[model samples]
Target: MPANIVAQARGIVKSFGGEKPALGGVDLAVTPGKVTGLVGPDGAGKTTLIRILAGLMTPDAGEVSILGGSPAQRLDSIGYMPQRFGLYEDLTVRQNLLLYAELRGLPRDAQEAVFKRLLDFTDLARFQSRPAGKLSGGMKQKLGLACALVSTPPLLLLDEPGVGVDPISRRELWAMVAELTKEGIGVLWSTAYLDEAELCDSVYLLSEGELLFSGPPADLTGAIADRVISVTGFADRRRLALTKALDRDDVIDGTLQGRAIRLLIGEGHPVPDAAALDLGPDTKVAPTPARFEDGFIEKLGGGPEGTSKLAAAYREIPPSDAPAIEAKGLTRVFGAFTAAKDVSFTVPRGQAFGLLGPNGAGKSTTFKMLCGLLTPTSGTGSVAGFDLRRSAAQARSSLGYMAQKFSLYGDLSVGQNLDFFAGAYDLSGGDAREAIERVTQIFELEQHYKRNAGTLPLGFKQRLALACAVMHQPSVLFLDEPTSGVDPVMRREFWTHINGLVRRGVTVLVTTHFMDEAEYCDQVTLIYRSRQIASGPPDALKAQAGALTGAADPTMEDAFIALIDASDANRDEEAEAA
Candidate 1:
């Protein structure tokens, strides 16, 4: 290992009695004052490699070095944060700090200074007395990061620390990590978000236990620069154009960006012509800058194309002029704290609707009310033309829901789980067998049908969850952060299936932290501080924020952050006036 390298791994390999090794002859390095990103899809051996490097697990074969010592020998000099950070929920912020400080072997005399610095750095000084469980998602993440830095370790390992964090909080977390790197701390960040990978000083792209690429993010993106382009003038048919383009042999990948279809074509192909793609003649194609995700998907053999078999099996509901979903003055209160206040929205049949918000912003509370998982403290909601308060069971029966976390039975086999969910949905005998057979074949789960759901890869688990949700083929679907930790390619696959369902007259109400995914919605309501801040179509909202930001093209993320900032400023001004 070089003197500048803080940690190094050579020929690392590990397997868990599977046909493929978890990590096969992988090599990686971390240097001082730099962020080295581990970028890959779920089940890409990232967690396994990180565990081996953290000394928590031993590799079958490998040479490792950490700060001039073995990973196991230098445990005290490394800060490691796993995907599910261990924060004591009952403990107050200060108490959590004290406990971590003690665990890190910090002397009592030195604790106060360290604790104060962490609290100030993480912006948690005012919340020191509050229990960890009472904090928002972003605050909890910051506290976890603070705990890992208690001893000021030389190297830090973060495994998907920004999974469910909103754009604003994600940027805040990145800012903190960036500050640490400036102080000569080496960091290894594992993430499924390719945009984060693009910001790293260097990146190790892994897939299926192999190192696909390793270097500056720009280098990978540069490979596809000439082949990338954005097609405009598709108008309202942009989604249809994107689906059509991706199905072509020349087009390697395509996604809707605002009103344009961003595409990645195969090498040696000329720039796509509008007529060639069956788009109207007014459509214009212009070469666009390639992004890290563009390259990532291209390398993964492109995203899924064509309509979903699962969606094709769906049965359309009867036509109705009434909104498919309606929430009128819905409010929920826990004690004196209002989780959702007078929230309202309407979704037409076959339309994709989005509910977006920051952490602890009442979106989830509103979602739960619509899902029939929680009764609103006041107000009313309806699903599929059925009143929620009066016909909760009928409304629930008309919808399919995929929770934020995997909600299927982990102990059961994939086939068993399918059987169970089918039965629960009232499908029995011929109906149960048909639905099971349909999902298994459509989702490509036959290979793992007998395997336990718990042992399946993250991507496979997600597939199983979605399959179970759609077993009954309900008229409405509720997806809560459906692709929270999934890679770009897998996310695209899921959305493609969703789009197919929408075209078949199935209403979709989804909530996601990924702003890019929000662009797919026909209508969106942005909630903050338990109230609606903005409600409109995606392009209209983007245009509204663009007017304030003075940008020609503002992305969904830009609009989201701008709206929140504006909302905060207004609240601050009101407080000052009072």
Candidate 2:
């Protein structure tokens, strides 16, 4: 073993039921005093590899070691946070931290000091007394991270720690990871977000249980240096059509961003002749720095294949004339507490509208009302041309909904679940069969149709949920954090389906903690403290957020932080002036 290596795996192999190989001859190494990121799309064996390293599961074959010892035997020296961090929601934040501290065998005095430091680092001091169940999604993620950090182990394994966390919270968590690495704690972080890979000192790119690339982020880009270009005017139909027409070559890997497309061309590949394409005279093409996303997509062989049709189809949906979904003076109060106040918004037909806010910002409450699952305390609303309060069933009939958790029956087969949903929507016999077949193909669920739902992987479960939701071909779709625990590749695939649905005139209303996902929406409504604060396209929001943070080229993450910070500063100023 290398002297600085904290953990090492050689030729690891794992299989389930002797047929499905989860990890195939995988090799990984985690060094001490650095953050090593494992980046890959869903079903890429990230979680399986992490589990093997954490000693939670045994690999079918391979050598695994931690701190120069077998991970199973040296489990006490490592801290593991699985995708689901086994948090006891019933416990208070303090209690949860204390429980983990004790389990890790810290003395009372040491536990107190560690607990205080973790709470301060996670910024949960104000919510120490709150039940873990009551914490917002971001806060819960912080709490999970805090619990994992309680023992302060030298080797930390985190599986998608920032999956469903807000940008601010994600930043804080990464900061904590950096701090730990500085203290000589080895961290193996698994994430689907390519942006997060940039923060790591080293990264291992995994796909289909194979290691594609492993090195520093800088090295990854340097290897493909000067091969990326930013092409503007992608929003123009003619230009977009031309770009897609030329995308069949293996040399080009293009990804759309708003009105622009970032094309990753192979080294020495000739640039397209702008004049030949009839692109506008003002069409601007410039070399742009390669982001982690670009590098990952390029390495993965030109973004996901067979997804362009979905993208193009979604773009064809006409903007709604009347609001496909709307809330008018919607208010939800619990005794003396008000969850939502006068929240009103109009989601145009076929548009991808997003509702974003901190946990408990009344997003879920508003979503429930929009879905007709919960009636507003005082307000009138309509969805799909049906009154939310009086014609909920009619409204529901036109909408498809996927909840945060995998809500399908565990004991049933995937085909059975789909059949049940189809029948519930009143599609029978041949119609139901056709709907099932279409959705199965769309989600690539044909192979897993006969498999038990409970035995599927996280990504598969998410796919199944989406498949079920769309089985009825509803005109509107409501997704509540649908990609929360999915891997990046799977996340991209999921969005491809969403875009396809939208292009076919299906309105989508989604709420999510991932800020990057927020960028994909046609319009966004940002809620804070039960009130709508900012609403617009992501670019508009970014321009509106000026000079409030670290960099001038503020990303959606940076913009969100700045917006929230500015709101708080204004509140503080008002309080002082009073």
Candidate 3:
């Protein structure tokens, strides 16, 4: 190992009674004052490697060194924050910090200084007295990071710390980590987010259990530079165009960005012109900058092929003039705090609607109210033309819901879970068996039919959740962060099914923190601080933000941040005027 390397691993391998090893002959190094990104899909050995590096798990075979010493002997020199950080919900932020200080064996005299520095670093000083449970998702993440830094270890291990966090909070978290790295702390950031990898000093791309690529993200991104392009003039049929592009032999991957279709052509293929894609004569194709995700998908042998079979089996709903979903003056109050106030939106027969906002925003609360999971303190809503308050049961029966977290029975086998869901949806006998078989084939779950749901990879779990949610083929679907924390390829596959459903006249209402995902929605309503701030098509929102940011073209994330900042400024001005 080099003297400058903070941590090193050679030929590390691990297995958990599976036919394949969890980690196979992996090698990596982390150096001071730099971020080493551990990037991979689910079941790619990232967590296993991080656990071994943290001395929490022993690798079956490998030589691991931390701070120039064995991991077991250098435990005090590394700080590890796992996926679910251990934070006592009842404890105050200060109390949690003090607890971690004690666990790290810091002296009482040194606790106050360390706590103060971490609180300031994370910008959580003012909220130190608040209970951890009361904090927003982003604030909780910051407090977790602060606890991990109480001992000020030289090496920091973060395992998907940005998962489920909004763009604003994600940027803040990254900024905090960057500051720590400036103090010579080495950071190993493991994440499914490729954009986050683009920010690292260097990245290690892992697939299955082996190392696929290691070096600067730009190296991989540059490999596909000439093959990336964006196409316009699809008008309102962009989703259909994207679907068509993904089926092409030359197109490796494609996604909807505002009103444009971003495509990555296959290697050795010529840059696709508008005519080559069977697009209209007015369609314009122009070369675009390649992204790390473009390279990641290319390296993964391209994303799922063809259209979704699951969508093919969907039966179109009967024609109706009524909106599929409607919410008017909906409000929910918890004691003195209002979670959602005067939130309103409407989704047509087959449109994909999005609810987007920062953590602790009223988006989820409003979503729950529409889903009939929570009763609003005032106002009314409806789904599939059924009143949410007067006909809640009928409204619920007309919809399918996939929660933010996988809500399937983990202890049950894949087949068992499918059967249970089918029965719950009133599917029985031949119908139940047919529905289960259909989902099993479409989701490629036949091989894992007997496996425990809990042991499946994250991607498979998401697929199963969707399968369970849609087996009965309800007229409307409610998805809460359906693609959170999944790899890019998996997300694309999930959206394929969703778009297919939308095309079949199945309305979808989704809430997500991923701004890119929001672009897929026909219309989006952004809720901030329990009030609707913006509602329009993705391109319109981006145009509004582009004018504000003075950018020729602005991304959904750029628009999201700009809109929120503008809103806060207006609120401040209103307060000053008063």
Question: lDDT scores for all predictions?
Answer: 0.91, 0.80, 0.92
For each candidate in turn, the TM-score is: 0.98, 0.91, 0.98
What tens-digit string does per-residue lDDT give for candidate 2 at 295-363?
A: 787677655542434344232445558889888999989889899899998887877898988767888
Compared with the true structure, the alpha-carbon lDDT of candidate 3 equals: 0.92
lDDT of 1 by residue, 216-264 (tens): 9999999999999889996777767777788888998887776788889
Q: Rank the candidates by lDDT, best first.
A: 3, 1, 2
Best candidate, lDDT-wise? 3
Please state the error at residue 576 of candidate 3 in Å: 0.9
Q: Which stretches of candidate 2 lie over 4 Å from their true place?
A: 18-20, 234-247, 250-253, 266-268, 276-282, 305-320, 547-552
Per-model root-mean-square deviation over C-alphas: 1.3, 2.9, 1.1
Over 4 Å off in model 3, which ranges? Answer: none
User: Of the candidates numbered 1 and 3, which has the greater lDDT value?
Assistant: 3
Lowest summed lDDT across 10 adjacent residues in model 1 is found at: 306-315
lDDT of 3 by residue, 158-204 (tens): 99999999999999999999999999999999998788999999999
